[model samples]
Target: MKITSAQAWWVQIPIEADKQHVSDFGRLRTFDSAILRLETDDGLVGWGEGKNAAGSAGDYGTLVHLLNTEFGQRLIGRDPADVTYIWEDFYNGVRAGKARKAGHVMPDLARRGLTVAAISAIDIALWDILGKADGKPVWRLLGGAKSDRLRAYASGGWADKDNIGAQLQSYVDTGGFNGVKMRVGAMDGTPHRSAERVIAARNALGPDVELMVDAHGTYTVSDAKRFAYLVRDCDLAWFEEPVTGDDKIGMAEVRAASHMPISAGESEATRFDFRDLIVGRCVDILQPDPACCGGITEAMRIGTLASSFNLRLAPHLWAGAPCFFAGLHVCAASPASFMVEFSLGANPMIHNLSNDPVTVVDGMVAIPQTPGIGLDMNEAVIEKFAKKG
Candidate 1:
């Protein structure tokens, strides 16, 4: 179907004080994102999400403006099935033809940041259109679903030492998730303090449950190593973002210093960044946030990179409906992916915006089999939480 119109909105949902949590990103009181809607000439519509900030809080005005302006009219008259070409065209800018002819990227200087976020949104919407046109799910188009069921981990844990165990166990109890991830690093103040919390959490959960910690790329090499050493016997499933994403060498050093698996790249974009991580041996697991990264197309490419290099794929899904559902399809089709991230926090975008009700039963989730992303946007939710200029 030929594209007719593309539109975007800034959706900001407030989290109650009790539901709010603090980390290096500060108190996450609001969930923010740019949601896109792409309509075809024949009237079929596709939905997508774009995330600019790391965590859940940021002003999405610029992103929404970009999507509604530059990225919006540009999509008109283009085939919705041209997902990869559109992504490359955006990344390469005016040099798209040259890059395609040369079989190499001639990307713009504005390749990262909000540019990719916009591209990610459009790419996802394009895929959604493609899936709907063919009356098949996106996962089916991406080779095929490796499994009908996908395992997911509880993706939120932010309590202190005393309440950490109870908080995580509640995640397990609520969703039957045996594996859960908790926050560490800057939030805990010190490596030692974070280590103590990990110990305390382990003690409460016992030896059977899997524990993972994320620093949000907020650690120094020495501090990350120290914390890894302290948790050596805790049997952590992974140690994520041991150091800043910019410091790939530092991340590699931290990985080498610990037995725990190092995972990162939620703050990154495209396959090139993931290629660097693989080539540099910076991490054991690759975590690409679909909304911040290049949507499903680039995410599957990153998953291919992970598979080719023996690394694991676990996309960061702390996002709105489009990004989370895109992650679900990516995880469903990629062999390198072992689990999906199901947010345990009070995320209004994920829970309220999509008609798809994600049920994590016994730590596993069923992949969506319906056409498109297997869900429809709740227009009422969008209208209710949409931020106005």
Candidate 2:
């Protein structure tokens, strides 16, 4: 079957104030998502989610238009099964122009929203098509070794002060979680203050619980150094995104000075960018987001590179329907994957968007065995939330 049309929908989902206040890591106060839908001639449809942040609705809209109007034209009549070829053509074709480059040149941002998000949606759709074509789950198609179950980490530990410790305890009480991650670096706070928070969390979880700290790239080299040293006594699992995404040198410096394992690349887009960071020895762990890092197609390549270097992959995931499944498939197939992130905060989109909602039992997510991504979109939910734009 050939790809016939591509469309994108932007959905605005608001997070509760208490949830938003869980961590002061960044300026984001609301949660939003850009969902992409691809249609084929034979009536098969595939879905993907675009990576967008607060106040970035316009960017997602532009990306959808570019993909549907421009990139979609390129895919029309192309065999939906040729996932890799289509990805390469789109990468080389659309990214060659000045308009694309201009869009990519935003400060402190990776490539433009459209470039990464649009490609990510299409890449996911291609994987879905490939799974359907082969009559197998995406995990098996990606050569997954362990399909039974994959370990997961409790990702959203940013609840209010009184709830943070209890929230972590709840995850452990549920059983099967190998570890948990907590947010840090809010409001230009000093490393000493951040260290106190980490220490408190460690004490609450006790010495056995594997603790991870995500600075959200909000700390400077010096701040990271101080906090890393302080948390070293606490036995942190890893320190994530201590510095900005572009700061390879800073990340390398942090890696050199810190006792904790450094993890990053969530903000990075393509394989080339990750290659540079890997070659530079900038991070001890790689956190490639399937939605932002060119979807499953490029995530596999990144995972392979991380494996060659003996680096760990724990993908960054905090989006809606398609992103969760795409990430789950990659993490299931990737040998180097240490664990995948699961948000504590609820998103109705995640709960109701799929026919088979992704569920975590005893902290382990079961791999979907059905064909394609192993989950079908709930059309009723989509119809209710589909954006007119």
Candidate 3:
């Protein structure tokens, strides 16, 4: 079928917390998301979510306007099934400055957050359409190598530090998740107390269960080295974002100085950014958020590149709705991906948005067998919490 139209819907979803909490790494704030919907003349519809962080809503708003008003017109008579070709045309066309003069700014972190997010949603929808077109699942279309059951890690351990052990134990006991990651560096730059916390967790969980620590890019090189040295005997799976994402040199320094594997790149966007990381050998694990990192198309390319370098792909997921499903699909298709992240906090928007909410059984998540990301949006819930512009 030929292309017809593309539209963007910006919706606000509130977080349960009142004020934005400051973690040791990055600022935490809540806001609405900008969703993209693409439709073909034959009635195939695709969906995407843009990177809508705290103050980046306007960036996505502009991207949505450009896609709907400008790019949509250009792709009107083209075939929607040409996923790769269409992506190349759109991406290269923008680089060629065809859409740049049409009031669209060059993609930045804020712009890319929205651009990539929207692109990821559309890319996923396109893949879904491809699957339907071929009468198969998206994983099979991408050469399904593993089973549908994805090993899951119990995330969202941001409760009071005192309650962390109980919270982690509760998820392991109730959710049946054997692997768990805890949020470290809670506003304090020191690594001494945080290392103690890690030791305590190791003692509590014993040796078999996998435990990870996310510094959230909050520490300095020296601090990361200190923490890594203290917990070197604890057997952490990986140390995530030990320093800020921008500190490549610092990250490399941490990698050299510490025995633990360094993981990062969640704050990065596009393949160009990742190319630098890969070429520099800055990290051992690459965590690209499909929602933030130029969608599925780019993420697949990034995964391939990471595979070539023998790096692990574990996507960073912190948003609601489309973010989770999109990440899931990429993880399913990527051979190098080790695991998928799930937030354990009480998030009504995420729970109500998906027609098929994800289930984690025995520390693993079963991929949806349905069509088109294997999940449908809850329109009624969308309307109920829809943010007014």
Candidate No. with top lDDT: 1
Candidate 3 lDDT tens digits, 57-101: 233465556556765567677776777666655555445355445
lDDT of 1 at 78: 95
The lDDT for every candidate, in the order shown, is 0.91, 0.76, 0.71
lDDT of 1 by residue, 1-389 (tens): 69999889998888889998888888988888899999998888999989999546568889999999898888899998989899999999999999999999999987899999999999888888899999999999998998988989998888999999999999999999989999999988999999999999999999999999999888899999999999888999999898989999999898887888999989899999999998998999999998989999999999999999988999999888889889999999999999899999888888888776868999998888988887678989888888877
| Pick by lDDT: 2 or 3, better one | 2
The deviation in Å at residue 200 for candidate 2 is 0.8
How many steric clashes between backbone atoms does each model show? 0, 1, 2
- Estimated TM-score for each candidate: 0.98, 0.90, 0.86
Model 1 pairs whose backbones collide: none
Model 1 misplacement above 4 A: none
Candidate 2 residue-wise lDDT, 1-389, digit = tens:
88888777666555556545435534444455667777888877788776744222234566667677877677788898878766665666645354345654222233545677678888997788678777888989888646578888887676544556777878777655759888877543788877777777787888887888888888888888878887788899998899988788998999999778989988888788889889998988888887778899989899999999998888887667788888889888998897878876556556667787577888788877877777688877667765675
Tell how far residue 324 is off in model 1, in angstroms.
0.6
Clashing pairs in 3: 48-121, 120-295
Worst ten-residue run, lDDT, model 3? Answer: 52-61
RMSD of 1: 1.0
Which candidate number has the best TM-score?
A: 1
